[model samples]
Target: MVASVPHDRVRRPEATACAAAAILAGFSLACGPAAAQQATSQVQLDEIVVEGAGGKGVAPAYAGGQVATGARLGVLGDTDTGKAPFSVTSYTEQFVRDRQARTASEALALDPSVRATQGTNAPFDSLYIRGFPFNEGTSGEFAFDGVYGVAPSFRVFSDYAERIEVLKGPSAAMTGVAPNGGIGGVVNVVPKRAGGDLTRYTVNYGSNARFGGQLDLARRFGANREWGVRFVTSLNDGRTAVDHQKEQAGVGALALDYQGERFRAWAYGVVQTDRFNAPSRPFFMAAGVPVPKAPDGRRNVTQPWEYSDVDDRGGLLRMEYDLTDRVTVFGSAGGSHTGVERYFASAPTVTSAFGTTSTAPQFYGLGVDRQTYEGGIRAKFETGFIRHAVTLQLSRYVEETSREFAAARGSYVSNLYNPVGVPAIAPLRIGSRPRLSDSTLTGLSAADVLSALDDRILLTVGLRRQTIKAHNYLSNVGTFASAYDKSATTPFAGLVVKPWEHVSFYGNYVEGLSRGDIAPATATNAGEILAPYVAKQIEAGVKLDVNGFGGSLAAFQITRPVGELSPARRFSESGEQRVRGLEFTTFGQVTPQLRLLGGATLLDGELTRAAAAANIGHTPIGVPRVQLNLGAEWDLPWIKGLTLNAAVIHTGKQFVDAANTQSLPDWTRLDLGLRYATDIAGRKTTFRANVVNATDAKYWAGAASFGTFTLGAPRTYLVSMSMDL
Candidate 1:
């Protein structure tokens, strides 16, 4: 059973303007019939030289070009952070359009160990890296390109990303099992391809009015152009800044490539949709209460006739072939489909401290489907003094989930600093969705790395062996109540050690694989299905890079396993959390017109086992202990192209239950931006203005690892122009 799709017939406005004009007419027929067949070929082309060189494509941008000098370490491809010993960052597509970042958690907000456990007008996109929980609830932890059930399963926009990588800790032997057990970090994405020729356009505005449009195109053909194409699309809609909200979105992406010389290929596709009317939910305190103060950020406890809808479709296919020149063979396959519908109202729970709240509006539905497959072999020989680089992988992933809900006959009472207006309640519709859960993962990995002397020593090792199957059924009838098949192996080791050509010194020890939790329904062994947990990490680092700036300093520790409910209430995995962290990072041009990007992490989490033993040493619920960012940009030796930027984000106090006595406080924010650039009528333009929370701090900004808490964003205001068509 899985029939449900009616949000007023998918919000007809002529079906979103005929689905954005049939996706801009299929992006002009994918580069207008390959440039009208190379302009009536007699074949005499030869001026396509497009080079911004960086091996295996998409990596070049370091040194003030806005991050990226290597990243994409899943199966270890495209790496090079001083020979990788982990802790990577990557970001570019010109830093997601100079930070106009519309998603992927706002392009990871300059990573201070990431955090965004929902909100930025939530409709899905949850995070919190280093201190755990990356995309929670029905998880689909990022990754796309480096594969993982193909992206877009709950929001990931940033128009056809060309970069966005982050790796930080446990990788399950370098990316394999993570269908829902994100061991602290890993983000990936990297799509856009087609270089040289292009067309661009943008137009945006935000804050209280919203409105947007964007399109980008790229092209290339044969006769050595080696075929390529790219397309991106976007559309936005009105009113926002909270209070009875409104938002709409759409996107279409396409990327294709082939730079063959020995076979190489890539293909991608995406389609997205989102709608909200009262979308935003995160707050659930009510037990011993206490944890309120955080109201006016354009407060709106929903009910503008509540609504929400989402749809996503995804695709990917990759290929490689060298077969010699030191062996290469590669493969990829992907799939994704997500669907959701909502009528809202289910996370309000404030209950006092002068805020008082409660909710009940439900009409939810959800569906997810995913698929992934990979194959690999990478070689690069030399055995004498060690040169290696070997790799060997095999992966498979699958998922399916479905749900439906209907509740809302009563229940209400609100006030988060004045939010009243309740009268529409006939919702509760969503018929049939059942199925709920099924997964299958498989793996087999191997790694090598090696390298010695002249390369200044490096080493890495790996192992995977995963395997996990799951099932859950019984939503009303579907049978099969709970099952799990497990296996695990995970392991890895690393070391770098340049020691001077600009410094480098790293270390690692990893392992991760999770999937084991299922008992809920207040557990008496409710649905059982456990067994398959393992997480462990250990890291150390230092990486510099001098002159044009770059930095890193890591320290890590992870340890996982947690599932609770005992005292004979039954449900197990015992419990344990441990996080321990210390990151620090910096990036590119610190002078030369000034440029720099954020960093700072320092976590400490802990709860070394607890089913309640007074919650062991506590400090786990939403673990915060400092996260920070810095960001900067400047470059206006008197306006030639002008520029200026800012950022300051911070977070600290957390804990919101699990006996830590309810908490959440420390906050800080600030952001600002500006841009200029010349030529207008003759094209080549650019204009921009930004101001996110530019001092409109209302606090409570994060926390969600189940303790719920998000709500912070209200100083909005954005503007954009962009040209070059």
Candidate 2:
């Protein structure tokens, strides 16, 4: 048994403040001498020679400029890739290293438009992107290392990532399909690779008896520095604060690279396994009534009899060769296989009964197997008159899934007696049903960046043409088959102007398209085909890069028609939506020893049309009206090797149903962290302590269609230690 930290004991405000102040003082002392020396040297520097033409040569070459470049989050791309017509936010390894984010969902919580819903069982994570319900199978799409792959919904881990990028607005021009294209966004996760000398280890312990550790190692070899390798491994296990809940997980990954002056080869493999208990659903009070809690002050809806488990493994290979100084060729192939087995109890509520609730054993199993292969070749050529870049790509993807649902005989009790009275049910056996789908996409695109007007103004124009083929197979619906093939020519144009040294203004227009899949509605129309779905969006924004501060503001709008709803075999032409919003982000040093990073968003999302059967049109459920994040990091002069950090987050109220009859109230939360670092036994070691939800705020994160509400985690504390060699 493990001892638990009492919430009241950890909530002492004076102690928390003292710890934070000590850490900040330590960090200040650690850097005081160095900072003084640098300040003195700055007074003796010589005048730098002017280079290039125009006002660019008049700009000061300050060390602070270097920090501006290094402060970038690499998730946006390989480097400062520049902003697109749409809003894009990049979180770099520096940010991750400082926050100590444990999962992809945790990392994305900083973004206002990205919301995560934790699963009670398994490794499942659901997201609401741009006010639209998105899942792994739907509009919320995820990519790894800039490539598409199937990630297990129930069990997910983000230990081996370098950075995560969130691209707002429609992206059909890049990714071939958008099951949730109407929502307008995509998340790209960049994987860590074997680059630079690296050796790091970390261990963490949290309340509720949780403990875990991770190791990362990388090395380079060969005379020309042509070969490199990186390996990572991690393990975690323990019970959560929730009742009847425990979790255990393990992960491993290896990456290899070979690079020369003209060519590069890379390969990677990852495997992960997790077993965890799920949370119970919660009951909610009716409108105008007071909120309710469980008898034990807990809010679990599922009985203690059910649990969830998952296992995932996948790999990828990529190769690139420079045929010429202005041209390059690349190819990549990867695949993943996932299997899930679950035993749970599902019962209909008294309000609207879909089926009888039972304690009898029920089994639901799903196996998903997918493979993707893509190849592309591109060239960059410039003439004094115009600059152009062209790329042509062809890809094929295939996914097959097998699902089984069955009921067991007799009342089944695993650990405790049934409270609601178990039912003696007849034996029922359902054979496995299979679903297969395949997509072949071919695309050709060209973009030109022109500096036509004395190089003062820049314009980028591009176009893409794509053809998609889709096929579907289901075991229960006899032999129902249909094919959809269409080609779309999308064009994009943008303008960037620099009227002053510290400011840049830009505007852009881009088009997006999403292909729709067809399924048999009835035996008579089994051969009928539906038209492909398409979405379009436009956005504009401005960025300011002054000496001491930087910020960006953007607004966008997206529209798309609904496609066929899967499994239900129903057409949803009325599923039209429009989302428009503005985002503001700022990060920099307010003073020499104080730094701040924060942002806010105000947005509106409305469903212009609902399925004719429902006849409901209103603000989409789950899309909040306002979101905010603010944080500060400060260093003190008295202590050495320490730092203090604090942050506050708030989310506005949001509707919970299609008709906007029910709603979740606004919520606010606070977090604090203290860290100290020093060299011990010839190794660099660091310690960190953090409190999440410091106020023990109680709020509902979301609600399911079944009228069940999900509660957010209460106040919790964590401590961790890390070393570098």
Candidate 3:
């Protein structure tokens, strides 16, 4: 049973001993970032039929298949993307159905270090990667198959993903401590499994009158076929391009599997609901206005019966076994619950910029419940020439939240480039609902990865000890104003060198831990709570893969600690916020009919200390020293299956305050796409179309590192069709 007869017997990796995983990360355990049950409890079914055989665990696709040569580095189970030293990028599901992207930040906009800070009809899916800010409803920061209460604290809909990696820097010791820490990195999402024979259907459309449909099913039989099943569903309804915004969504996902020889299992389920009508607002300045002039991205000052609604459900189950062939044991658990209702119309305070504005009217009801768990143990050893793979993990996440909001006293003055709307005021309620917050995140990690010379020199080290508890209650005197518990220990290191097998060179050093920062109403000791901060990073990179393309270039630095205002103005936490950078990217096939993906970034952010010292060396507000992305795809060589694409996005200036005298300019956008495939009568078809912001530029889509401001995302149009049913 357990690894039936040594599970195809094989062993040749040995270098062992990582000091019992750095002394068991100092004890208190639970936390496994992207731990696929710690590599399926150490795999082994002849190492999954030797490398890849139906029990598929991600990775495959590189070279024009829309990215993915390697990903899932939390515990390094899918290594090789030039032997990795960090800086991942996955994205594939045929690149989100040929870039018809409906979420996951528009398929990560082909990452020039990611951006998507809640613009584009805004059903909310915030992001900013690499230069900070990550707000999926305030820091839950996505992740799903790789854990994190099954992603959906605010947005998660890319047809339930099938890959979306994006790792970058500061991985609390390689995926273990991120219960809202997000030291500027992390985004995993890999759901949708169940292989072979499948039936599908899809229909979609967009542009001011949305429409959608989707359903997919997959199957497999037993007796060696190993049993599997998959199901998916989706629906959307629409109206958007701002002005009167409207949206509706629904999703259902299910997956089941079993592959045995030494046992393998899987389970996943999800249900989602969504709604929005008129919601899309963020652009407040005031304090000394002057950052105006960004009005017409189909202007909509949100006031036609504002709305938002959401509901969610979840499930997960996982298993593994292989207590031989060099050990293996795995486990996983999951939970999820969410509900939110919002009535809005905030952000619109200008003060003066000739476009005068003002608005204040909000209401909200929120509820959240989350639970997660993970477990692991892995081993594979060798010594003489070095070779090892060891891991020990534990994880936990808990959450409970409840909220009620109010803010409808009176105020509505318009003119942010001529905008007016009134008649809606009813919010002065604030509190009386009870349970406001709660959180718990635990972790324990230990790792090792080595391979000497012949394997091309690779090394890795790990440690994690996270723990962060939080509380805040007082929704109406239920008491508990605050409570916090903290702990930290994050550490990691990595190195890789391949001299040339296609080129590779890497480096890493990481640390990250967060929780501690609550002082925002422009601070003045605003809500207090500070003392759980740690962030550090250092990176170096180079990668390339010749023939079929694929490239990378990196340089990094990160630092953290903040809480602003306090040259006596109190608010403390001693501030700090470095973040140097230099990144470059590239992707598959530069020939075979062209294909490419973007990259470019170069920042040097700052803010060393605050509270007036003239904002320390400035440059913090909303970070943007340059960002770019470029995409291309072509394959019209007499149209065998057709394909055409284009993408280009840019961001450069940003700063909306922090005393940086206001800024916010510099933007660009352009996107276009097409897809085609055929088979018709025998069924096996595909067709797609897209056009995003194609010259509908009215600028201003940057600055949301917390101080509002968004626009730029107007001209959009999409279409889709699929079949195999």
- Candidate 1 residue-wise lDDT, 1-725, digit = tens: 01111111223433333322323343333333344443334233333222331113776677788888888889878887878998988888777787798987898887899888788897888887888888687767899878887788788898888788988777977898788888888888887767644678899988889899898887656545566777889999988888869889999988888877899888888888999888888889888879878987899888878889988888988888998889989988989888988887758788888988988887878888988888888988888988998889898988888888776777678898898887888875646788877888999998988988888888888888998988888763456777888898988898998968989998899988888888888887687778888889898988998898988889899889988898888989889899899899898897889988888998988989988798888888788898999989988897778899898998899987878998898998998998887777666787888889888889888888889888888898888988876
Count of backbone clashes, every candidate in sequence: 0, 19, 14
- Give the per-residue Cα lDDT of candidate 1 at 105: 86
lDDT of 2: 0.58
RMSD of 3: 24.5
| Per-residue accuracy of model 2 over 384-450 as CA lDDT, tens digit each | 7665555656655555556666655455322111124233334454665555445555566555556
lDDT of each: 0.81, 0.58, 0.77
Extract clashing residue pairs from model 1.
Answer: none
User: Considering every candidate listed, which one attains the maximal TM-score?
Assistant: 2
Superior by lDDT: candidate 1 or candidate 3: 1
lDDT of 3 by residue, 290-376 (tens): 786787787877777778888888888989899998888888999888888777764767788787777776777787889998889
Each prediction's TM-score versus the true structure: 0.34, 0.79, 0.32
lDDT of 3: 0.77
